[model samples]
Target: MAKHHLDPQYLDPNYEPVVNRSGNTPFGDILAARMQRRTIMKGSVGAALAGLMGAGLAGCGSDDDDDRASSSGVASTELGFKAVPVSTENRVVVPEGYSAVAFLPWGTPITGAYPEYRPDGTNSGEDQEQQVGMHHDGMHFFPIDLKAGGNSSSEGLLVMNHEYINQNALHATGPSYVNGLRPADEVRKEIAAHGVSVVHIKRDSAGVWDLVHGSPFNRRITGNTEMDIRGPLRGYHKLVTKFSPDATETRGTLNNCSMGPTPWGTYLAAEENWHGYFANKGASQPREQVRHGVGSESRYDWELADSGADAYVRFDITPGSGSAADDYRNEANTYGFMVEIDPFNPQSKPQKRTALGRFGHEGVIFAPVREGEPVVCYSGDDSRFEYIYKFVSSQPYYAATAGGYLLDEGTLYVARFNDDGSGDWLSLDLEDPDFAAKVQAAMGTTVGDIVFEGFENQADVLLNTRLAADIAGATPMDRPEWGAIDPNTGEVYFTLTNNSQRTEDQVNAANPVANNQTGHIIRWQEAGNDHAATGFQWDIFVFAGTQGTETVVDGEAVVTLDDDNIFNSPDGLWFDYNGRLWIQTDGSDDAPYQNNMMLAANPETREIKRFFVGPTGCEVTGVVSTPDVRTLFVNIQHPAGNWPDASDPRPRDATVIVTRDDGGIIGA
Candidate 1:
């Protein structure tokens, strides 16, 4: 596939996204460097033998069961559950031994006095605030007991993201764009609907999870919520706006997709595909803004709201009147960073941690942390051709003193993978003259040249993270989505969710496919098995494909799907406490695969089994399990498949709680 311009048809498009338009000069440099190293290593038989036995070996039908042991020395066992059958039916289908229950559907009351959800879709903005939000995505279950070990099985605060609004199902008559403008109320409702929600939940005597109505912990952080701008870009000029004249504050977190739970007991809600919400009809957009796909037209036409309030006006990023402080031109920069929310403290203000370079952050997962050691977190830029990034805290992490403050100071680095299973993490710090020189050379221009534009400092380097990565010679990936680190090993895995734009010539040893309809999972072990290591050994763990169209690597099939387990577009990913890797998909509900589904994989044995299938038109995402491993929670998004109830006038996005019929461990 070829690179294309950002299409304004959908709010996110990242799920079915664009390719990086940046020239391939940097990638060529990486190839040249790798070829030079390959020539030297080709004659070393010992080196070749080591490479073959390295941690980077792809687990394609290999019996590496001994490598699946946890750090505590216990080996993982097989996934004993039967595979769930594939179907085009409009209901959730789980393995025969498992049971699925519809829980926390959109518009369900969580707090205050919201009227019951009307099938005709008459719920008001006020009602939605009190009720559950739409499009539930990445989430985590934070147990009430802080000291509880395992998966926090019994009760906890369920923090989740309401990604975007489905207009057709959100209103009685859908959104109305009359006379080139949207109704102010309709826009307000949409804004209120797109953010994060926190609901208190617990299991009862029957082992069914239920929402705790009117619980003090229940709250919603909508598009209008006040947020503090923390870290390097807090007082930077690029973040100045009428919302916060000093540039230390902004409003709300839009397009929240996946999330990460910090060891310090807070939640990191990622802002993905937020560029589509802005309408920057300015004469000439900034270089960074342009690189991020900010355009003249808003994706949801939210800027056309007929309201003069700053809340609605912020969506229009065009400069107006006096100076930067007098307008909301910089509002767009305030988003796209990981917003840290203290789930335990409802009164605490959410912080936008700018130290983690901004882009389309799909999600952030922390590497295993050790006391007195730097804390590391990894994230992916979901858009095609984007890069993977990691943040290393300046100070050591201590469990007792852990909090959002540690994230305030950090150095961000982008990854560049080599063909010989090795990769480098290039720091984004502009202070490093050597690093700056490499960036200049890669961009084929001097530091003060037009390529640098107005990006003069570290803040600029971070605000335009994609440009910096491109200039720094980082490797571009095919829609790198959710990432997870194996608890047993420090190995990192990223799902390169599919890129139709990747052509044959663009295919490399790592991303080895043309028109990559069924994506692949790439993993790496940090050098020395250290989370803070800047180097890593990499490999493709599994290549997702249909039953008949299997993917082969190095003369071996990485993973072969069967009739019961075929899937595509691996999106949401999570590794449970038990080390079972849960893979979720967000693909087209067509022939071979009629609906989005969730599958379980035993990484060691390279065995994947289909465990659950979502309804006809929905994407199965966000997954978590109880401490006991008996109860599992998965989110069903944009359910046009008429799941749960085919008779309902409008389909509802809800969370499905899965449990074994025998009340045993899930997927056992």
Candidate 2:
């Protein structure tokens, strides 16, 4: 059943690019436009606003003009793929005949008792705790395919990951605190509201997919919920805590980022920025302290002012004679694992798979499952110079299997790249000779094994995956973000977001470019398309650049294009089922590229065209599509608070849908 998602007119023939100054160049610009149209023309695949785009993304362009010269050949009535224009006022947009709907909006109820969100931000942590979580990111829709003569919602459970909370947005005036201190009341509220949200959605023959709010299946997995820790690293001394009566389970999930869907109908969500939650005493600590993995980036700043409680005082692990014995010195070890949520079972307890060694996980892209074969997942470490890891589940995945717990068992490994394009999937086993060699080499067995001996526990291995990967000698990358797996081919694509901080001297084969601020997406086709293979070939697919400027850093001329081709940072990513690669940007210091955007690209063509752009002070994040192709959902997040107070009515960041008119498909 080939379904049509967009209309032939997804981009009407009359659709004229605002500034497609093909073969045109601006004098005194950083560089001249070498814009030329080429074959396999790839274009950015997101929505755009006629107004803001004209104002904000006026000159922004792609790597080539040859890309814009041809028609997509997709007709509205036969729309194969398209980009539609929807309204954009600090919100996500889709093409005309398309619509934007808000789901899991900020302060949306997570629990049944939570109060309704009053746009003014008065919503408290009390009732809001159990409701749908905030800042929805990567999501998936599993259709409820019922046999004949059955009443089933065309829709299924909408499983989404809440990246992080917008305190100012979540609370009307930023994070609520008592005298600059996080109130336990507030912490408690946030704890209950941060994790995964599973709610049922249904669409009728008329194509309206509405949320069944009271659906018994609606559920939320918060930070306080108990999660069983599994994998090689389970039950380690480092994970044993005074809080965990049995020492194997942990209390919460935080910064849940991008996701993956199992062939067997389960949901996989990766926890990112888990490091920001701990409180480190800076680099002044001892070698043991540094070796313990505590650095300047811990979360909670709980050290500043202890509300004298776990909700506040638990973050600081300073061993300077202060009694952390009864507190959470070992608490940081609990986070940084891949959490599995069964969307079908609302009452199912979310489990953190420790076998997937932890780090700042951006996503978990699984290797397409094959019966009787090992299941593999690729993940990127978000921080600068972090490593990319892969998890080979111990058991083979069976699509028809009744049990969904297979994901809990797996052999987690990290990658170490070679200059000659060869790599190794370094395993993190305490008893392995390779592990002993690394410990002896880095820490000298005496201190190495003891300092990180807690990693001796697989829980330590899974929870502190970075450390395990470190001991395994994995290759550090240029701040890896989201990853996309090609559905047509089994190749895995991961983004190495910009890292300008690295000096030329620090450049290595893996992170080949120095001061490589504008990042690149690296694609690797597993040998035989086998994710379980220990080796794979790799290449730099698209080096990000400004629309029409050629950039030469330390001597490599990456890309040159027109004004529209210019792009600063690359972050969020999604490879639509159609093979169109959708890219979202997060420009941190590259303020010149104002109004971060989302670009649609053809992976095979490598042609990136600017499809949709965000509003003033908003980051374009969270991208997903319904199966029908009629509804396209994108999230406009953290909109404008970096500019002024959260109350400015100029625009409120929210999700919007885009559907074509005449009931035609999108981008046909």
Query: lDDT: which candidate is best?
Result: 1
Return the TM-score for each candidate structure.
0.90, 0.77
lDDT of 1 at 666: 75
Tens digits of per-residue lDDT for model 1, 1-668: 10124322132334433535666443323433332211121221110112333333433223555765433344554688788777788788998788899998888887778458877888787777777888899998888886444346788889999888788778898877767778877877788788888989998988878888778888888888899999899899989998788999999898888999998878999999888789888888877577777878776777777776778888899999799988888989998999999877889899999999889999999998899999999999988778899999999999887888899888899998876658889888887775778666655453212355435788888888878877777887778899998776657899988777767776543334566667778788887788799898776667666664333444444455667677888999998876788999987777777788999987776688998998877888899886667789899888775656777888888999999888877776
Off by over 4 Å in 2: 1-101, 146-153, 175-182, 204-206, 280-313, 316-325, 402-404, 430-436, 443-459, 504-515, 549-565, 588-592, 641-653, 662-665
Error of 1 at 282 (Å): 1.7
Tell me the lDDT of candidate 1: 0.78
lDDT of 2 by residue, 267-326 (tens): 778877665566656446433234334565344343444256655455665433433345
